[model samples]
Target chain A: MSETTEDIMSATYRALCAHGFADLTMQRIADETDRSKASLHYHYDTKEELLRAFLDYLLDDFESRLACEAADPDERLDTFVEAVFGPAEADDDGDFAVALLEIKARAPFSEPFRDRLVALDARMRETVAAAVRDGIEAGRYAEVDPDDVARFVVTAINGSHVREVALDESPAEARRLVEAYLDRTLDRRSEPEVPV
Target chain B: MSETTEDIMSATYRALCAHGFADLTMQRIADETDRSKASLHYHYDTKEELLRAFLDYLLDDFESRLACEAADPDERLDTFVEAVFGPAEADDDGDFAVALLEIKARAPFSEPFRDRLVALDARMRETVAAAVRDGIEAGRYAEVDPDDVARFVVTAINGSHVREVALDESPAEARRLVEAYLDRTLDRRSEPEVPV
Candidate 1:
């Protein structure tokens, strides 16, 4: 993993998150990572390259955690949602949530990053849809469009994190909201008497 | 309202959303508005103050549109949800949605803006809870915790916008998701069907 390169990339990602893409600079990242400017330049030729590395790192991490593992799909979906969107990790990371918020905002500006994100989202949806399809076949879930349900479920989970990060909501409140979302999402065995 | 101040603030807000808070400068804002930096500063002393003013402007606009005119609390709740979290404005003017997302990442550094957002959210929740309470009294909604339902509704609506903005989802999709959320929140009110 080239520890030095990884360190420099992580620092650059932090600077991009904390300050923003417009304020990012080699000097600032070097200062943050305690790496000399020449050393950083020797490792990464351009800021765009560094940015690409950052996205690749994140996508790799997410895929390794969510998609590349063997486990029950239902439990995997739960784990995936909790790992991606839960505020439980905020205790250890100073502002990872804020960084994610900034990254999502910057997504529209970079075609490569935007395409990667869309592809990743589609992969996650497919995984969840397959799980829901199995659940329906096994009579674990009632008849429903797996694609639509998967979209809503994933959106709700991801959306909760965005809300918490954007609103600076308390972790306790975030957990409560996530629980509420899960209850509704899992209670899909049959439709309520009312129409949505 | 001071037209000159409004113009500068509006342009500054737009630049912040288009660029970011860390990248915003009085000069760039003035350039966008076709005003001199001195003229812009004459209206706003510092960038921080200008940022505060822009935030206040959004709060004021939201309050005016959703908070002031509705005689019925339920109508107010519906209007607030529709206006704040509904489709991107028919016009190109980026409203509170973009500004809030852009500025929110900086909240950890600014107590005033963070506090204002929290208070604004609380006010909105109270309005929605009141509406839910009235609905319950009128038998339009089932017995449920109004506060919880209000919080869920607000978070879901705010969260949906992030996906909507990224996916360019249609207004119909937003309506469908919101309706599903509301249906689940009101599920307790539906009459249970008897087995044939």
Candidate 2:
């Protein structure tokens, strides 16, 4: 991305965080950015176009973070959880979550947004499933269907995200709950004792 | 509610289900109802007020459904899950889910919506906690912190709702996954056998 594009994206983020998706306007984004409105429009014709580009940018960043190789299954799982849950403190204010949700709520109406979200969901699920498979192979986890568990994990994280953003609940609680559930379901330590 | 108010609320529901919250307008709602635009204006005064009333109507209906006494703990739990996950087929299209998500996403910005959602969450948690406590007392469930489990259950349901609407996933899968998890964690059948 060009430096100007990057600056506009950052400004868009700031504006989204400040004004929310409902009230977000091109004028608001232009006010946040150093560039002229005409320049911004030259790059992207409409607010939806700009926001869609922003969504793509976010997914690209997310994919890059998940692309890095992890040496251990636990580390992979931890990274996945951390990416979904983010820092505990970030959950308190929910600026990022609110913006993401604004886009998600639009998915039903917008085909492009729906497709992008589906792709993102698929990538996240695949990453987690691979980690679960690795853990089972390494004798570090219990026997369970990795695919099923993966779906559960994704759904749970999404659920937690909604609760955190909607109810102002701590994301830490979601993290802890999911981690504990994963421990019980996947951790070898919690596996039943063998018969004598 | 008066008969006219009931008719207006019904029209609002139809309009919401059709156009969604983002595009909803008093004129559209008026189109759905037999009443004139002026009448809708007199009844609602604003779109926000109408939506607030619609939300209250939903909560009232929800509370009434839940108010019926259930004798068994499992029955109570099953009812709660069903309410959250809804019918499996409903997940496929997500008309009601989309409208509800619209309101939930707005809770952060709307005080009335936020307070109503908070109250609904509290009512739900209290109901689930009571069932968990009842099960524990009756030796039908594993001993666990009812409050913690209640929070987890609600979070999971909220998460599943997000996935179902946002990604168009099956609520059946979410329902099965959560029921399985609950069985593992809370079901007496899954409890370990004591050594003789």
Give each model's whole-structure lDDT.
0.66, 0.82
Query: Once model 2 is optimally superposed onto the true structure by TM-score, how far is the C-alpha of residue A66 displaced, in angstroms?
Result: 3.0
* C-alpha lDDT of candidate 1 relative to the true structure: 0.66
The B-chain TM-score of model 2 reads 0.88
Clashing pairs in 1: none
lDDT of 2 by residue, A56-157 (tens): 877887886776487788888888887777652343367878877877887887888888899899999899889989999988889999998888878878
Model 1: runs farther than 4 Å from truth?
Answer: A1-39, A67-74, A85-91, A188-196, B2-23, B31-36, B68-74, B86-90, B93-99, B164-172, B188-196
Q: Against the true two-chain complex, what DockQ does each candidate achieve?
A: 0.39, 0.70
TM-score of 2: 0.89
Sliding window of 10 residues with minimal summed lDDT for model 2 chain A? A84-93
- Kindly list the per-residue Cα lDDT of model 2 for residues B102-167, writing each as its tens digit: 778888888888888888889888988999899999998899888888887777788777877788
Q: Is model 1 an incorrect, acceptable, medium or high docking prediction?
A: acceptable
